[model samples]
Target: MLIQKSGHIIVNNSTNIYEEGSIFIYWEGFIYGFNQQSGKKTIREFFKNLQIHGFCSAISKLHGSFVLVLANEEKQEILVASDASGQMPIYKNQDMISSSLIELTERTDLNKEDLSLDKAVEFVLTGFQFGPKVLFDAIEQIPPSKIVSVKKRNFFLINRDKEDDPFLRTVKHDSISEYLNQWEILANAIRKEKVSIDLTGGTDSRILVAILNHLGCSFETAISGQPTHPDVIISSEIAKHLNSHEHFTSIHKVDEDTLISDLYEIAKNSKGINDFVGMHRLFQLHKERAKRGISLALGGGAGELYKDAKQWRCALLSCNSKNRLVDKLVNTGFVGWGMGSQTPDQLFQTEIREKSANYKKDTKKFLKDIFPEYHKCDVFRLADEIFYKYIIAAPRGFSPLMFPHYSPLLDAAFVHYGINLPKHLRFGHQFYREIIAVLDTKQEIASLPTTRLGMTLLPKRIIPEVLTSVFLNLQKRKTTISLNDPNLYSLLRKRLKRSNILKELVGIGLLNPKIAIDNIPNKNLGRLVSLWLFLRILDKRKN
Candidate 1:
């Protein structure tokens, strides 16, 4: 058996090996096999002219995320094949070792002298890395669906293409009744699995629990929040109603001193910037569940499933004025005022101009594909791009953790179904208002049971307006913006003033510099507010 680059490979001369995450090597006299699971058939038969017989035929028939290496150790020749998706990476460096050193050298580093930092930065900013580039210069991913073989020092490329016979899109249902029937199919899928769900007091997760209960699935529910947050209360109620064991944790008052330590641990373990405090708690939760023998955890991710993108589409349909769409976009939460008050049109233009050449190309193609009727609008283009990349991918990445994370809402089947449904059916006439209504209906899941306890911090709602006002005021500008009502402004101001650490960090300019530079009085002043607040909690924990 040979293990290379975090995968298992076995050389067998006596038997036929069949297993997932396992590799089989056929060699002289006997067949050897390695598998993560136990008691698999190792060798089945022997035949003369084995290389020309069923050996190659059987090898070609195997399908999975794996690599196969066939060798006639007596004849001293080898062939290697990889699966279609290349979900399991396989790489070989030729002439780096002799027969005597083959056992010692499990993997070889790739030369990355041509690695591009600019491309890396652009990819990271877009929220996903692409192609074969790894963080390490010496590493490269094996491209999906490729076959490579090595015999002595010579290498051969056998197959390189996407999987043929792509899965067909299934859309047999036409009405809400049919959609409900499809939902039944999905609920049954969840019921058949040993599953746990991250149940926030939100419409999405609540709907999932309701469906699970209807399907007669025995599931466990987990919630994260401050003790008194509305979500905790609602999730607890739903869990009790469903008769599912409920686990709730208070994160609002998490020890400040421990936050930094945990952050460091998270940084070491995580792959991307999108990971934040919530993930750390999730990791701990997974461990606890694993100890109790749970294997699958479900959550309602993919904001599109619950939040209505159809709002933008509806606004586009009813209103011919671009300005109206812009206003509606902001009110509907399409434009992130927190990021900046750039109008939707302006944000669209900036992103189109600045993002990757590939992204621009893809956006142009997507615009044509999704909105063929309308002349190209920067607003629609931008919304579609951001919706798919940042908004959709963030929660999807959670699926790859050590434990399987299942989100039926994000399931391709469900998303495609929702996309084709009429806007009225999905979110009703006034989109955002309708969404809030839908959310309120599932209020049992939407309320948090407790407030996050820590150094008092500005309420999330007022930060944008306060920052905008502070910036405008410092510039000697008087703007009558009714957006920040007095009561909310005063509450946020008190929270800001009370957190000396946050104030100091914000003064230094760290949390989100671009936001600080544009909104704060002093550009560099808010450097470490979020980080410092996070670290201070960690420090207190140690003390």
Candidate 2:
């Protein structure tokens, strides 16, 4: 077995190995190590039994995030498997397989444009790029809980979730106990590493804090931005409460010109990635922690999968009983199809918007497939599927190069209860709060401000609201680097005109080139800037 990697593959012998044998594995996840002999004993056990049971049984029996590829040299066959709920993306075309979609596309022989114009427009409209049909049309991605086998020029899907998998056993008088137990189970999975939790006031990270606090695990926290930033202040309080010291790294401000230039470079290098803007700050935070000698960062990413992150979209797409799916999409907060339709029809310098004009039909079909049992099921479950695909697009595509990041929320055990638990109990994290109430009793789960939902002040709503308002104001003092900024917004518009994006926009005519910069505000500007940066990337990739 010969081992090869582009940066994405884990390089340490502890988790990385290439052998010249029939069974080949690219395992990227937490696995327990034995002091006795085998470095990755947990991975060893799974690999030991994988061939005997085949991919499905062995994969299902294991826990944590990973992709295992088994190749049979003698039979000229190969099996690729991943966690039931996905993490890393696996891209394959009969001749080769890799984790990076851009790398694969570059290496392929297909006569493809650097970026698929139709897909780029679709992504701009929908904030989504599907794996099977992606930014590069000819490539494909492996979704979670799946097995794809290649042999004799034939392909097979070996492990798809049965309907019963979603409705796991997760209801009882002590539902809180069940969830608490699961949390401990997940926390214990991290073994022999310098652990650090990327602390935020958000419920997701707080959940990890709860587990760590409960287990008496000694760890540090890394908080970015300044003390007045709500995340910083609230997380400082949390750190004090947990008795774990946190490193506060102030983000040095950069001017708009520098920021835009950086954004262009980032999009080009990251290959038009999602879920991050200005990764400089994120890495700055991590670098601060690294100086303190902390590695293996943990996040609450993907915890939203269990909550109704997109209840409105779920209802519209799932129920489909509504007459104006396109209208709702055009109006709502959907990063994609949402506001594009609302843009005035006269702005086209050419023909961009028209390329994805029939996107409504595609949107409805995609939504229908994802939410077939929408009416009958818990909205959280539907939201879970949505978050699984889009939101995690950040972590799935980006986490490999960031740090040894772990999301316990994606664990099968953690998600199992989240999925099967009674929908009502799951709402507002009633079950999550109950566990905190039972354990810490005064953890203030309700008072904590959430990024997804705005800050909620419980007990004394008015008083906390006043304090939160003050904190927000102080934080906003430095929030001027925004598309909403009159100056910055103008700069972005001018920059867009100089780029080839408007030319491409004219070709597709999906977006009106004539629309004034004033019409696109802060949120839209972020997307617009992202699209502008994307066009630069597209130009680079195409050439």
Candidate 3:
């Protein structure tokens, strides 16, 4: 933890924590080049580099799922930053900095009742809160590409040196070849160590498999799901095609009682940032792998940077003004993610609804503050960037805390490349397909059907993309795992009945207590449950 006291900065040392003359460094998750090195060694080298080249210059060359904190006694300040993709999250309060949101709550006066109603509405409508602000007004996330400097109990933003900042580096829109070349550097670097790949029935993981196979990297594949599930079947096919050993962990085997308990624990740890429904399986899978002497695993997180345009298709392209664009961005994410259209109106009180009218207006200013080029970027690119940082980065970054994980695609080099690529190529996932086609030299992997895409990659057609989007939109409506299951529903209702936080929200006109927990709409149940669980945890800490 980094704290300010008596007008001085203090840093506590522990594992993965490094200290030098006047600099104390602590980091989580592994960087690409430092994967084989101990955390101490990585920090030692970072400190040395900092001494030679300074802060921003030292971090510019580093990449992967990491969050770094440097407490400089000489400078009397603490510096915090995350990886290029912001895969690891760190939060800041008034005078303290910590990676765990729940920990921050305990260390500060922030309670469940201090929650931001606008952010609450946003979280219920979209799966995650938008912008830097979290559920509480006092805690805010540090942006991915910028540094947060703490001095005399105050926070200041420090921009990275633009010339070396990968996200800011300009490349031609058609620089796909260059992009792949840069991607291969990180890919090959990661491949040097024996790592397990989280193969799934999705475009992202499949792309990883194709690239690794093309490069002749020896690695195993793992999937978590029932044998009958599409992900299991498709991932099995990909593994068989590559002649790679595959591991399957059935989600059905988890004990119901234990799963429910784990759900609350996950909610507490993630502080409601992650939807805990399917997360347990991944957590269990990694735990089992750790027991088998496997720690490092590669995930296909942040892959949407290459192909996410649904928001643009539905609303962004037609947006006429800044406010219109903000409304479309927020609404599209809310509706596109399968949170019901009625949630905003049904989940909150009348006063909140009136106040939420300014959410879009506020979000416009927020985006402009964090992303200076917000007004200049095309709608498609802007939407992708917003969704990447705000919606997906938190949960994806939090996954590593459960186990050691890295996403080769989430590397800074790829982020720069993908963000700069023309939006036309990404509109219908043309860029993703093109990369898969180029990498799947034997053509076998492309023939396998993707569980989400509902088709093989060989016959790339617009019809499949359209049909897939429609199918996903329909599936999002039924995302009520806890509510639909009799056992889980019973457990959820019992816990929610005991929730003082839920009652308080109702008292404050943020939640409608008249609506029974069991009767909450299917589309809104998972998010509501997550919020309830998070608040209940905070209430526990407060008491």
Using lDDT as the measure, which candidate wins?
3
Best-to-worst TM-score order: 3, 2, 1
lDDT (10s digit) by residue, model 2, range 253-287:
44556766656544543423442343435645665
Candidate 2 deviant stretches above 4 angstroms: 1-15, 18-21, 29-39, 109-114, 160-174, 250-252, 255-261, 264-272, 275-280, 287-294, 305-331, 334-350, 355-361, 370-397, 442-543
Candidates 2 and 3, the one with greater lDDT: 3
**Which candidate, 1 or 3, would have the higher lDDT against the true structure?**
3
All candidates: TM-score: 0.49, 0.75, 0.82
Tens digits of per-residue lDDT for model 1, 56-156:
43433233223455554454445554433232234343332111111212233211222233333222233333444433344334443345455554655
Better of 2 and 3 by TM-score: 3
- Superposing every Cα of model 1 onto the true structure, what RMSD results? 13.5
Native-to-model Cα distance after best TM-score fit, residue 517 in candidate 1, in Å = 13
Each prediction's RMSD to truth: 13.5, 6.2, 4.3
Using lDDT as the measure, name the better of candidate 1 and candidate 2.
Answer: 2
lDDT of each: 0.40, 0.54, 0.65
Give the TM-score (vs. native) of candidate 3. 0.82
The alpha-carbon lDDT assigned to residue 424 of candidate 3 equals 69
User: In candidate 3, what are the lDDT values of residues 226-276, reduced to their tens digit?
Assistant: 666677777888887875555554454555556557777667546236556
